[model samples]
Target: MTEDNIAKHGKKGTFQISCFYVGEALCGIDIGFVQEINKQVLLTSVPHSPDYVVGIMNLRGKIVTIIDLGKKLGIESTANITDDTRIIIVNSKQEFIGFLVNKVTDVVVADRENVSPAPSNIKGVKGKFFQGVYKYKNKLVAILDVEEVLENE
Candidate 1:
């Protein structure tokens, strides 16, 4: 373990990204930060908010804002929502936001070299929301920045 070896190898940047479905489209998030998966409940609609902000919901007496992942990510939302559809809650800089998802997919690990920067021109001006894009299986999934994606809302 010498400085030369460290310098030559570079630092590892691999992340264990968890794949989740928003309709047929595939998407991923770094699993290290996902807090828990809670199913839907009585969400109180917050009036005068952005379209992406669906509303607020109570979780064990604490209120949480639900962010529509499909709307926020510029993807066709998962329709015909069922009992399996869940709310994936994550924390970024101490703020908690819930993403309405169709279902939870298995988690997979990716290497540092496999991660690629998001393209400059993502359709619908949504390119900036992603932290990076990585491959899981043969399909490409965007890794979203939880904080940046929810900060404005």
Candidate 2:
């Protein structure tokens, strides 16, 4: 990972990551890419869009495309929008996009060296979406490759 993609913590090689849940699996993204986490907002359905594209919403005057992250990642689809549902907004390519997650978790401080490569068992399209996996509190947090997840299929 490049310095620009991760936010350095006090230690030279450590960084903070925003963790969240997509179904039962824990996932995370580099804190550097996150703009904000927003609650469920009214979404205007977009016709002729991809299945993963939930819809679009106006976030403080800016139009943002919201994607069902779980579905995009080949995880369980986020079919219900509950109180725990959140939209993780990220500024990418000068545009703002939001990832709809099941719930917002904690910000984890992890060492760059500790992140293990995406497991060999996680093959096919899903494997390409992960940057690596970091062990946090006895659990594995799959780190997402934002660019890959945001890329059009």
Candidate 3:
């Protein structure tokens, strides 16, 4: 944990989080939920799936649903795959899924008490999709509610 984290979290229980970006917004997920992170993985589109479902990919014989994190959060699709674009593979409710993010930032320890309830609207993303929000480096990192995000529409 960095001194900044300690200063901001104020001695509360802290845990590490994997930070990433969705467009320009900073976001994070519990490191424990993340299985792996891949870059530019080949994806096959799924017909009749939700608009957020980018496609599916085979990961060592396991089929994982690929979700465009931006689209899932009501942001526009990532038009081009750049070097920074990545797929964060996470296990939610026993199902493996890949979330496409603009970039993977860093892992930082966050104080539990520092997490506050999500605002009704955050960078055009609905609050229900967020578990909470934390302040980091003068910016807010929205902590993704993985279970809520994986729930069927």
Candidates in descending TM-score order? 2, 3, 1
* Candidate 1 C-alpha lDDT tens digits along 1-153: 234422433456555777787766566777766877887745788899888777788876767888778887777664346887878888776767789888888788877576677665444436677666777668777776676677676
> Candidate 2 — which residues are off by over 4 angstroms?
1-12, 121-125
**Preferred candidate (TM-score higher): 1 or 3:** 3
The C-alpha stretches of model 1 lying farther than 4 A from their native spots are: 1-13, 78-80, 121-125
List clashing residue pairs in candidate 3: none
Q: In terms of TM-score, how similar is model 1 to the real structure?
A: 0.80
Scored by lDDT, model 3 comes in at 0.84
Model 3: which ten-residue window has the lowest total lDDT?
1-10
Q: Distance from true position, residue 113, model 3, in Å?
A: 1.1
Tens digit per residue, CA lDDT, model 3, 74-135: 88676358988999999977889999998999998987777887788888889888777889
Q: How much does each candidate deviate from the true structure in C-alpha RMSD? A: 5.2, 3.5, 5.3
Candidate 1: Cα lDDT at 39 = 77
Question: Model 2, range 1-153, lDDT digits (tens) per residue?
Answer: 335334432233887889998888788998989999999657999999999999999988999999998788777787479999999999888899999999999999989878876764342337668777889999988888888888883
TM-score of each: 0.80, 0.88, 0.87
Q: Mark the 10 consecutive residues where model 2 has the least summed lDDT.
A: 2-11
